[model samples]
Target chain A: TQLLEQSPQFLSIQEGENLTVYCNSSSVFSSLQWYRQEPGEGPVLLVTVVTGGEVKKLKRLTFQFGDARKDSSLHITAAQPGDTGLYLCAGYSGYSTLTFGKGTMLLVSP
Target chain B: DTAVSQTPKYLVTQMGNDKSIKCEQNLGHDTMYWYKQDSKKFLKIMFSYNNKELIINETVPNRFSPKSPDKAHLNLHINSLELGDSAVYFCASSLGTGLGQPQHFGDGTRLSIL
Candidate 1:
């Protein structure tokens, strides 16, 4: 089984601060996705990176996929109180299914 | 209308009981999946169905059964539930199984085993 390990399991920051979370794995992936989930709700898809060394930006969030497809990163700029949630990274390696990380809990204080 | 929806958002049940969670998708997707999220926020895929065919079945117990009545509906039934079964179950669907097709998720059903 492929395992996606996420770093900084918990993050607490103030408004307008910038932070980044990393997702690393030992196996290559065909696709990588980032999701944000709120309390009592399922995860919402934010972005998907299919190619190695690809970068995608969504408003204050920027996502990047490593050249080897074994790692991905999520950067949040000017985080607001609404950005408080759980951030997860899932990788599909053309195997059985997508492997998800343990997720990083982010708390943005206003 | 919601793209994907699951009924019984919160379920509280006792051990050794049988229960089911229903899911429906209106996105006309060809693939559907069941995922479990534990308290540590680790999401694990339990089952995946494509065109009513079982595509992937993970290392889950036999007590858990997934039934796909149609392309748009997939349901999960658990028999003799254990305390370890308590978690949030999410239903997701995608247009295809490729990497380009992102899966849309429904509000999860929180199961609490008493």
Candidate 2:
């Protein structure tokens, strides 16, 4: 079984602070995806990185896929109160399935 | 307009009761999936249906059955629900069963067993 390990299970930060969350695994994936889920809502796809060592920026959120395709990171710059949510990283291997990581809950306070 | 939607945003029921959750997507996607989110916020895929055909079935219990009546609708029926079954159920859809396809999700159904 493939397992995706995520770091910093919970984060509390003031507005305008920067934070980074990580997702690591021993198994390589074909693609990686990042999702942000707010309270009482389903997860929304933030970005999808397909190539190794790929980086995609969406507004203040930047996502990086590891060079080996076994890890990924999500960096948030100048986070605001609206950026507070649960961030999840999912890896897609063969067979058209996704292996999700335990999400990191972010609480940004103004 | 809501792209993907699930009914009964909140479900509170007694143990051993049978329940069903309905999902519909208007995005005209060809694939749909059901996922369960545990208390620790781990989202796990339970099943996947493409064009009303079952393509992926995880190690979920047989009591949890997913029915796709058509390409636009997929419903899940749980028989004899247990306390461990209490979790948030989300429905998602994508254009195809490809690796890089972006999945659109609906607001999850929060199920609680008493």
Per-prediction TM-score, chain B alone: 0.98, 0.99
lDDT of 1 by residue, B1-114 (tens): 999999989999999999999999999999999999988888999999999999999989999999999999999999999999999999999998876568899999999999
Q: What is the per-residue lDDT of model 2 for residues A1-110, given as tens digits with 9 covering 90 to 100?
A: 79999989999999999999999999999999999999999999999999999999999999999999999999999999999999999989966798899999999999
Candidate 1, A1-110: lDDT as tens digits: 78999999999999999999999999999999999999988889899998999999999999999999999999999999999999999998873378899999999999
Question: What's the true lDDT of residue A5 in model 2?
Answer: 94
Ten contiguous residues minimizing lDDT sum, candidate 1 chain A: A91-100
Model 1 TM-score? 0.98
lDDT over C-alpha atoms for residue B54 of model 1? 93
TM-scores of the models, in the order given? 0.98, 0.98
Candidate 1 A-chain TM-score: 0.97
Q: Which regions of candidate 1 fall more than 4 Å away from where they truly are?
A: none
- Go through the candidates in order and give the C-alpha RMSD of each one to the true structure: 0.9, 0.8
Q: TM-score of chain B, candidate 2?
A: 0.99
